[model samples]
Each structure stands twice: as C-alpha cells, then as structure tokens.
Target: MPRDGSATRERILETAERLVIDNGFAATSVDRVIAESHSSKGSFFHHFASKNDLARALVERYAAADVAHLHAALEHARAATDDPAKRVVAFLSYFENDADAIMSAQSSCLYVSILTERDLVLDGTSGQIEEAVVAWRDGFAELLRAALPGRTPAGVDIDVDALSDHVFVTFEGAFLLCRSTGDSGHMHRQLTVLRHLMEALLGAVAATPPRRRRAGTPSRH
Candidate 1:
C-alpha cells in the first residue's frame, strides 16, 4: 500500500514546479512553496532534502519534456523534406513556433534563464542539468549534419562539422536575443537570415561536381 504521505510529497513537487516556472528558481523560496502547497516545512523536507533538490528535479522534468518535443520536431522536419538544407530550415521553423508559444505562455524562457546563471548552476547538482542542455544543443548539430549529408565542398575546402556547429549556435543565440529584447520580431529576422544562409550553402554544394574517383580507388558499391 502506498503511504498517505506520498500525496503530500506530490503536492510539494507540483507546487515547486509552478512556483519555479512563475517566479524563477532563484526567486522562489521554501516558504513560498510551502504556502503554495499548503504543506508544513516538515512535509516539504521529508519529500526533498532541500530547496536545491526540488530545483534540480524541476529542471530535469523540464529538460525531459524539451528533449521529447525537439525529437518530435526533428522527425517531422525529416519527414517533410528529403533535402538536408530544407529539412534544417523546416526544423528551425518548427522550433521557432515552439519558442513563440513558450514565450507567450510563460514570461520566462527556462533554458535561457538557466544558461544566464551558469556560474551558480554549474556549482551544484545542477551540473547534470547543464550537461543535459549541452546534449540538447549537440542533438541539434547532429540533426543538421544528417540533413546535409552532401556538405563537402569541391573547389574550396570546407568543414561540414564546423558549419553544423555554427548553425546550431547561431540559432540558439537568436532565441536568447529575442527573449532578452522582448521582441519576437528579432527571432523572425534571425531565422530569415538563417534560411537564406541554408539556401546558399545548399546551392553552393549543389553547384559542385562529385569528387572524381582516384585512379585505383575501389568504389564502395
């Protein structure tokens, strides 16, 4: 049988999630969570070792949801277009929409908030949270590479891996800038520029002929 105390624990977590979302992790206090949950201090501590533990749990929960949505968006983009460049643009568009909705629903951007507090967040158990965030960024880079398999330049040498990293970093930065400025227009402008860059890269790659086989190199197929 489950302990009746489990219900109180859940209430505490739920309240913490809400308070953190609404007031931010730093601003939220144990007193606020307790009042919000209508639970005693003992109940809160019984459920979580400390407020930091609750914050860690809240970040993990948010990260899981964000990753799931990102994967779904990537899948949709892949299914929508065969061209790698087109797929990348589609994925960014999907992400832009998601960001728009989040900005509208919550006055705060969770990822941006965590990133801004990197010094503090990195010092504790939240280090795992930072790792999760980096993984998410790397996931975006991987998706970009998969979408643009023919990224090798012919006449001029270009590093596909570097290019992919640039795209991912730029996109993430654009979101942060948009949120900081409270201007959705900035996101749209930045994405438009990114779309153009994608088209140019694709065109450049398409214009290049396939690398000629070496005199005695065996073909894979």
Candidate 2:
C-alpha cells in the first residue's frame, strides 16, 4: 500500500472504532466514518468495499491491537513474577487499571459494541468478530490453564475453557451493565469481584506443605 493509503486506512479504522463504541455498530454509518476520518468517499471505498467490509477490517485491526496489549500485559506480569498464578492475577490487575481509565470516560472496548449488533451484514464481519472474541477468550484461558496445576479450590474440577468462559462473561456482562446503567463504576466493581473469584477458584492453596525438620533436630510436638 502507498504511504498515504496506509495512513488513510488507519484513520478510517480508528474513526470507525470510536464511532461504533459511542453510537453502536447499527447506528453508525459509513458516511459518518468517512467524514470523521477526513477521507474522501472514493478513498473510503478504495479501502473498503462497503460498510460491512469496513466493519470486518475494523474487527481484525482492533482485535489485533487489543490482543497485542493483552500479550504485553501478560508478558510484563511474567517478568515481574516467577509464579504463574501471580501472573494471572497481574493480567487481571492490568485490566482493572484499564477499566479505571474507561470509567474516567475513555471509550469502552470496541468489540463489545460491535458484537451487540448480531445482525451485522453478512460480509464476513460475523466470522471476523467471532474470531476476535475467541482470540481474546483463548488468551485468558491459556493463562488460567497455565496457573491451574494445583490452585483450584477443593471439590472443583473446572477445565481451562470453563474458567476462560467465566472470566470472559464477567467482562462482557460488566460492560453491558455499565453501559445500560450509565454507571462507569459498574465495570470496576464487577472486575473486582472477578479477580476475587479467580483468586478463590484458581489461587486456592488449601494448605501448606509440612516444613522439613533440620538435620539432627527434634521434630515438632
């Protein structure tokens, strides 16, 4: 792509992501995006076959960036701690901090807004959206699985996928509640509960191992 085309593409995607987050996918229009992005109609059509095509590209582009941020967060956690469970907690903490920013009136996740429009045009946008969602869910599941060796609470037998689903649901539900109630704090509160639940479910170190006795020393009474 030419330098100008690449820049125009990015601008279009950014504008669409912002508009969709604010007004929802169904409510936003291609003309609005073109106008907001400051690109001509021909340029918009050059990069996107239609609004549906733009939606598809939006999902892929935004999802890639979002997933990359998650990966970086997890990596940073891994660097700061040797414990896998702690790394999982760190990942959630990063999201909590991010949600704090959102509550401060930053934009909510774009994918959340896009997914609500289940009637998206059948221009492959559905698959793109699904792929984006699964990518995010799987990333969390992979981390949770890594931390699941012996951390779950007693009598619990959840697979990684189940745990991932729970975490993902918590996030999506929180977003919905916050948007519906016009309460930004809803997300932070829900995520706090989620973090605590994970600690209970996946950080359950029921008991400590017995300490080793010193050589030639008497055992504890």
Candidate 3:
C-alpha cells in the first residue's frame, strides 16, 4: 500500500474504533465510518473487505496494544520491587494511578462494547479478544502466586486464578459503571479499591499464622 493509502486506512480504523467504542459495533456502519473518517467508500472497501473485516482489524489492533501495555506494566512492576507482594501492589498501582487519565480519554472499553453487542463480529476477530483477556487473567494470577508463595490467610486457601478473574471483572465492571453513570472518577475509585483489597489480602497473609497440615489429612490446594 502507498503511504497515502496507509494513512487513509489508519484514519478509517481510528474513526471506526471511536464510533464502535462510543456507540457499539451494531450501531456503527460502513457509511458512517467512511463519512466520519473523511474517506470514500472505495477507500474503505479497499482497506476492509467488509464491516466484519473492519471489526476484526480493530480487535486485532486493540488487543495487541492492550496486551502490550499489560506486559509492560508487569515488567515495570517487577523491576520496581524484588518482593512479590510489593510487586503485585505496584502492578495494581500502575493502573490505579492512571485510571483518571485512562477514563477521561476513553468512554468505554472496546472489548466490553463488542461483547455487549453479541454479534458475529466477535468471531471475526478470531481469538484476539479472548487472548487479551487470558493474558490479563494469567498475568495477574502469576503476580498473585508470587505474592502468596506459601500458605494463604489462616486455613483459607485462596484461589489465585479466581482472584485473577476478579481483577479482570472489576476492571471491566468499572468501565461499565463509569459509562452508565457518566462518572469520570468511578474507574479510578474502583481501581483504588481493588488495589486496597490486594494490599489487605497481602497483609492478611503476613499477619495470619499458617495452619499446620494434620497427618493423614488431605490438602486442599
């Protein structure tokens, strides 16, 4: 593709992403994207074979950037601290600190918007969305395991995987609530709460004594 063609394609993608994030994929149309992007139908079609193709491309681009940020944040957190618990807290704080800016810049999550539409467009993106989510879940779980290297609080066995899922759910739910309430601070507050919860959990592990395993008793890992 020529430099101008590439620029036009990027413009269409940006316009489409903005529209889809704001109004959802179902309501966003090819004509609207073409008009809003200031590109012709010919250019739109030349770039994307169909609306589904556009959606897939959007997901591919969004997922790549999203996962990249996730990885970068975790890497930064790891470098900031040698202690597992502090590293985990640092990771959460990384997002919590920027939640306001992130919320101000984006009205809603693109993945959430796409999922809510429940259209075949999700399939168009292959497994990009799922992979991005998995990356988040797995990344958090790894941090959680590192934080709780031994026995959990008292006799309670914390499920790191489930806790990881909670992180994703909380983050996404914050976006939903923020969008619904039009509260710019909602996401930031939610992230702060999540970070506090993680801190408390870590504190609990530190404060509580680990229960000794009884002889002949089965362990519930």
Candidate 4:
C-alpha cells in the first residue's frame, strides 16, 4: 500500500496548528509537533522546511478561512435586507454570532490572536496577517459603501473607510477585552453597541438584539 502523503502532511499541520495556537509560535518547538503528531523528522521536514514555514502556512490558512467566513455572513445579511444601512447592521450581528460560534468550537484565528504574541509573530507571517486584517476592513467598508446609492444621508457624514476601520478595530478590541474579562457574552454586547452607533449614524431603526434563553434551553444560532 502506498503511504498517504497528504494525510501525513495534514496531520502535521493540524497538530502544529493546535499547538502553536495554544502556545505561542516561538515557544512551540518542532519536536513538540513531531512527537504529538507521531510523525518522524523526515515527514515533518517533507511538509515544512522549518518552524517558521509551518507557522506561515498556518497563518495563511487562518486568513483564508476568516475571509471566507466573513463573506458568507455578509452574503446572508445582504439577502435579509434591502436597505444598505440595515445590511451593515445585520453584518455586525452576523459577525458577532460567528465569533460566538468560533468560541464554542474552541477555535481561534492565528492572525487576530497574533498581535499579542510578540515573540512568535515572525515578519514573514505578520505580512500575511496584516494583509488579512486590511482585507477584513476593506470587506467591511464595502458593506458600508453599499448602504448609499449616491449622497450620504442628510447630515450623516460617514467617511466610509473610517467607518470600516472603526467596525473591524472595535470588534478586534472587543474580542481581546472579552478574552481578558472572561466574558463570553462580551462580543454580543460590543456588537449591540456598534449596531446602535451605526443606526444613529444612518438614522436607521436599531435592530433588536437576540434574547437569552434560560439555562438548558438550546441555542437557535
């Protein structure tokens, strides 16, 4: 039987990704991944030249997944509302929901979490992370831009690019705060605040936030 080369590589990547995310990249050694993955040095080297290369691949994968998830959520929002402002609001809700879902799944994005792990954030990988962040802001900005057909709403001077940055940066901050505060619901709270602010800016009615179900009740998500 032929050795499953792809499976071997995938196991190495998956094992390393989990380790690097749990521990800082610089701290997670190649031997740790090789030991945990039950793969030999040859197998690990075949897939990745060095620890840095492996981390870079992980960041690229993380960035691609983030972009795909954002696009899917925004598409859902677009379908739910005809008003551009309303759609932007819906995007926030969806983004928050996705964050919650990610939390529940015990998954994290290397790029978003990389900002704090200074020791492990290599320049080559940081480039990919930065690009991913910029893409997120641009994607968000597009939603805001779509809200207007021509002129800005009367007296509503929204610098589209700035607003985009505001939304992404705020969410990133909220996420970090949520982690630090040990509050799972903090993400939703931040989104609600953002929704209110956006509604005020666009003169759109605020959307109702999701209600909390009693304990043992299933989430509808």
Query: Best candidate, TM-score-wise?
Result: 3
Q: Which pairs of residues have clashing backbones in candidate 4?
A: none
Per-residue lDDT tens digits for candidate 1, residues 1-221, read 46779888778876776666556677888998999899999888887887767766666666666666656656766786777666776765655444444444444445544545555466564666556556556766776666555664667655556665554466566656765786856654665576568767655222122232233221100
Q: Which ten residues in a row have the lowest lDDT in candidate 3?
A: 212-221
- Estimate every model's Cα lDDT from 0 to 1: 0.61, 0.70, 0.77, 0.69
Cα RMSD to the true fold for all candidates: 11.2, 11.4, 10.5, 5.1
lDDT of 4: 0.69
Tens digit of per-residue lDDT, candidate 4, span 1-221 = 44768888878877877786567676789999999999999999998988777877777776776677667656766886787877887777765555565555433445554556654454656877777678778888887777765536567666778778887667666657766788867766777788788777666663435433223321211
Better of 3 and 4 by TM-score: 3
Residues 1-221, model 2: lDDT tens digits: 57768989999988988898889888899889989999999999999998777887888876666566657656655775667777677767666656655454434667667666665634456676566567667888877878887766678788777667676677668877877788878887887777777777665331222223223221100
Candidate 3: tens digits of C-alpha lDDT, residues 7-59: 99889988998999999888998999999999998999998999888988888
Q: Candidate 2: which pairs clash?
A: none
Which segments of candidate 3 are over 4 A away from where they belong?
A: 1-4, 121-126, 204-221
Which regions of candidate 4 deviate over 4 angstroms?
1-4, 106-108, 112-123, 148-156, 206-221
Model 3 TM-score, 2 decimals: 0.87
TM-score of each: 0.67, 0.79, 0.87, 0.79
